[model samples]
Target: MSNSMKVSFCCKDCKRKMFDYYAGILNLYIKCNRCKRVLTLKKIDEKYVAERMINGKLFV
Candidate 1:
């Protein structure tokens, strides 16, 4: 069987669901439809983590 898993998360500013993502999938950047905020995905400690990006600054 495949080892990949599904990942789902919400927007930090709007608290709305962004989209569904697969575990092995890597998206450099994602934009929230509601708030129009940009998010960056980074792999930390072997797991994918999301962080907010504004004006070229990274916010946790």
Candidate 2:
């Protein structure tokens, strides 16, 4: 059997729940369906951090 975990995060601009991902994913780049903004997810220090991409730059 394989082990997996659920990872959920919210959009920085909209404050809405974006999606639920599996723990196996360490990094991801996605667009917020509600606000239509680009977002990136990264794992740091055993935690998940969400950042927004704006004007070709990343904002935390």
Candidate 3:
């Protein structure tokens, strides 16, 4: 079986890198260490991953 979690947008803004988990596996919110931009992930059947940005652009 598989599982998923609805994470809060603000929760990811932690001071340090924290681990995000789903279905007994570990995943992370790919935020920039310098800019602290919370990288968003598009769920594609667990095998593929990508960043969610507006018009191929990202903000600080």
Highest TM-score, which number? 1
Which pairs clash in model 2? none
* Per-candidate local distance difference test: 0.54, 0.53, 0.37
- Alpha-carbon RMSD, candidate 1: 8.2
What lDDT is reached at residue 23 by model 2?
36
User: Which digits, one per residue and each the tens of the lDDT, describe model 2 over residues 1-60?
Assistant: 023434456676887777754434457688987889997657532233223333322333
Candidate 2 Cα lDDT to native:
0.53
* Model 2: residues with Cα > 4 Å off, grouped in runs: 1-7, 21-25, 43-45, 48-60
User: What digit string (tens of lDDT, one per residue) describes model 3 on residues 1-60?
Assistant: 235443222223443433333333233456656556666545432222114323322232
Which is the better candidate, 1 or 3, if ranked by TM-score?
A: 1
User: lDDT score, residue 50, model 2?
Assistant: 27
Q: Model 3 — TM-score against the truth?
A: 0.25
* Top-scoring candidate (lDDT): 1
| lDDT of residue 24 for candidate 3 | 35
